[model samples]
Target: MKHNVILVVLDGLNYQVARHALGHLQAYCDAGRAALYRLDCELPSLSRPLYECILTGVPPIASGVVHNDVVRLSNQRSIFHYARAAGLTTAAAAYHWVSELYNRAPFEAVRDRHTDDADLPIQYGHFYYADHYPDSHLLADAEHLRLRHKPNFLLVHPMNIDDAGHKHGLDSPQYRNSARRADIILADYLQAWLEAGYQVLVTADHGMNTDRSHNGLLPEEREVPLFVLGSAFSLDAAVRPRQTELCGTVCELLGVEHDKPVCRELLK
Candidate 1:
């Protein structure tokens, strides 16, 4: 079974950025499945709600984490909580609002509010931070966690490219360059993991629009990539084209029985 799952959420990443970073992402695509889909939601695509939904395998309202400031009303356990319950060690590296919402004081190790140099480690549970983009330092830290502690779940969030894209617009060279850099960083990190015989799952929390404006709910904003690597899983050959589905797809891959009532679909 694919016990060790590494989730990479690139905040505000779009298809254009992905294509620009194609070289870096090639290995991930070649190694496993690459499913692209339209997010199909409203505008102002905020990070907290989307991420929370991804984690809990529930919609934003059910998860109760919508927007950055609005916290979930109840305990509202997440994938991390479920992972812990299942006896899997969980670690996270998030940025911007994800770190603020998920990485609480005692349960997580968080870093950096604006810059991309934040690198913190968690002995157990989850580690989250918001670095501008992917970095060698963060990749090294993840490797250490996997090699030294062997955590079952490790989440890494890279924000620089997304920040640049939002600030400078997606068409700008700055956005393209940032995407390329992120791709390279991801390739290097995955190389290390593969060398260590580790399986990797690379994906995004949501996609961004070149328009450079969002209110947290839109199809473009919600649609994201779901790429997987390693020897355990196989890319559905019939489903070569991009497709969309609820976050429960991830739950299925990890062997976690999702409580929400929904039929599972693959990218076909």
Candidate 2:
């Protein structure tokens, strides 16, 4: 693979909320440099299951990561797996569950918090356990990985939006403020990443609801925002991309061969 990618999952950010709060990203969309799409995440709209779904192009029922607590390594091949198989480097600054899925299961914070094992699917990782770990710090961790390791595929998962939603509900200022904050933090490094030749995908595993909890079929829980920034994307508003399609799209962006279906319409 000759190209690189960074997938940022703004944990629990809703489509409506993102559209209103992510002004910096909206600027890219306004300038026609990015495409914003609204997509329904796979059920049951939980983080862990959808993480596997987004990375493997497989639904929860098929992947068997049907809930957040199903702690085990993914049986389905992920973007990290495909990237690694292609002899490309992979890294992530994400929730510990991500590490539990790709690197090791039953996360041991002391041993698994910082991993740099070549044998692991995510070769370089900085995994965090707390929900309030701070998005700014996570993005900084991701930037550090990008500058140091130059991974072909990097996953940046931040939990602040979800954390705010859980604490103050979706309609509260805290949730909206969190989205706004994440956007500002992203604006800080987006240009640098683009100049460095990395295609970026900003999205979420699922959305937060008014109930301050998810795992149901409500629109707020299922609907999420996808912002694609790169020359590889077509930026066509008519093309609807699925969460499951992300894995294959990323594979295509990195020139990795995979069986999963790519979002052909979304690609140039």
State each model's CA lDDT, in order: 0.55, 0.93
TM-score list, all predictions: 0.75, 0.99
**Judged by lDDT, which candidate is best?**
2
Residue runs of model 1 more than 4 Å from their true location after superposition: 27-44, 71-74, 103-134, 195-197, 216-220, 237-247, 260-268
Model 2 bad stretches (over 4 Å) = none
lDDT of 1 by residue, 1-268 (tens): 4456777766667654564465756645654534333233322356667666666555556556656567433245555555655655666656535444444332223333322221322223223354454455655555665676666667776677677767877677877787677777777677776566555656666666668645544555655555556555445544332222333444444566546432243411
**What is the alpha-carbon lDDT of model 2 when measured against the actual structure?**
0.93
The top-ranked prediction according to TM-score is 2
Model 2 TM-score (2 dp): 0.99
